[model samples]
Target: MSKPPLIPFSTTLFVRDTCLCLHVQRAARALARRFDEALRPLDITNGQFSLLMSLNRPEPPSMSAVASLLAMDRTTLTAALKPLERRGLLETFVDAQDRRLRRLRLTETGERLLAEAVPIWKQTHAAIDAHLGEAASDRLRAELLALT
Candidate 1:
C-alpha cells in the first residue's frame, strides 16, 4: 500500500497563472472590494448597488425577471433582497397583472442611494477602463459578455 503523490508547487503556479476561472474570480473579488470601499459611505455592498440599480426602471421588475438578470436563483435573490427590504430601500409587492408573481421596486431612499452611488461607480469604472486601456477594456468586456 502506498500514498498518492502530493501535488507540486509548480503545478499550482501553472494553474494560478493560466486558469481563466481563477483569474476571473480573483479579478471579480478585487473589483468588488474596490467598489465596496467606494460605496461604503452609502452603506451598500457592490452587489446591493447592482441589485438596486436593476430595480431602477419606469416599471418595477418581477422577482423572476430580477433573478434572471442578476444570474441568481430565485431563493438567492429573495435572500439578497431581505437586507434592503429591512432597510426600507426596496419593497416587494404582488404583481397587479400577474397575481402570482412578486415584483420589486426601489423605495425613494433606494433611488437616492443609487443616485449617489452612480458617480462612484462611474469613476471607479472609468479608472478601471483607463488602466486597462480603452480599446482593451472594450474588447475584454465584449469577450466576457460572449462567455455569458
Candidate 2:
C-alpha cells in the first residue's frame, strides 16, 4: 500500500491569510451586534434599521428595489418586513403605476423611531471611527465599497 501524501494544516498560505468572505462575515456579525444593542431601545434590529434607512430616501422603493439594495432575496425581505409591519413601523402598498409591484413606505411611527435611532447610530458610528481612526476608517469603508 502506498502512503498517502502529507497535507499541512495551512496548506495554502495565501488562501488562509486572505479569506475575504470569512473576514467580512465575521466583521459584519460583530458590527451588527453592536448596532443591534444600540438600536434596541428603538425596537429595531440592525437589519431592520438598515432597511428603514434605505426606505427613508426621497423615493419610496419597490419591494424588489429594497431587496436589491439590501442584497436580500424576496423571501428574506418578506420575512424581515413582517415584524416591522406588525409594529406599525412600515406599510406595503401595491404601486399604482405597476400593480404587480409592492412598494415599501415608512409610517409616521417608523419615522419617529428612525429619528430616535439616529443619535444612537451616530454614537455607534463615532465610537467605531474613533477606534479605527478617521483616515483608516474612511479608507476601510472605501475599500469595502470597492469590493461591493
Candidate 3:
C-alpha cells in the first residue's frame, strides 16, 4: 500500500488561530468558569443561576418556553430542573389549561437566593465589561445576538 501524506502543520496553526467556532467555544468556557467561581459562595453554578433567573416572570413559564429561552431541549431542561426542584428553589407543575404541559416558577426561596446572586453577578459582569471596554462589549454582545 502507498503511504498517505499528513496534513501540514501550518494548516493546523491556521485553524487554531482563525476558527470562529473554536474561539467562541473557548471564550464561552472561560466566561462560564468566571461566573461559576463568582457564584461559588452561593452554592450555584452559572447554568443554575441562569435557569433560576429565567423563571422570574409575572406568570410561570411553560416548559417549552423556558427550554427555548435557554436554548435547551426538553429533556435537558427537565434534567436541569431536578436539582433546583430538590433544593426547593423552584417548582414545576402541570399547566391548568393543558394537563399535558408543564410550567415552571421560582419558589420564595428561589427568589431570595436569586436576590443574593444578583449583586455578585453584577460585580463580576461589570468587571468583564470593563475589561472589554464599553464599546467593544456592546459590539460583542450585538454580534453574539446576531449569531443566535
Candidate 1: segments with Cα more than 4 A from true spot: 1-8
Best prediction by TM-score:
3
- Candidate 3: the clashing residue pairs are none
Deviation of model 2 at 127, angstroms: 0.4
If the candidates were sorted by their lDDT against the true structure, best first, what order would they fall in? 3, 1, 2
Query: Per-prediction RMSD in angstroms?
Result: 1.8, 2.2, 1.6
List the candidate 2 regions with Cα displacement exceeding 4 Å.
1-7, 12-16
lDDT (tens digit, per residue) of candidate 2 on 18-82 = 98887888899999999999898877899999998888978689999999999999999999999
Number of the top-ranking candidate, with lDDT as the measure: 3
lDDT of 3: 0.96
In model 1, how large is the Cα lDDT of residue 72? 99
| Candidate 1 lDDT trough over 10 residues, lowest sum | 2-11
Better of 2 and 3 by TM-score: 3
With candidate 3 superimposed using the best TM-score fit, by how many Å does residue 41's alpha carbon deviate from the native? Answer: 0.4
List TM-scores for all candidates, in order. 0.93, 0.90, 0.96
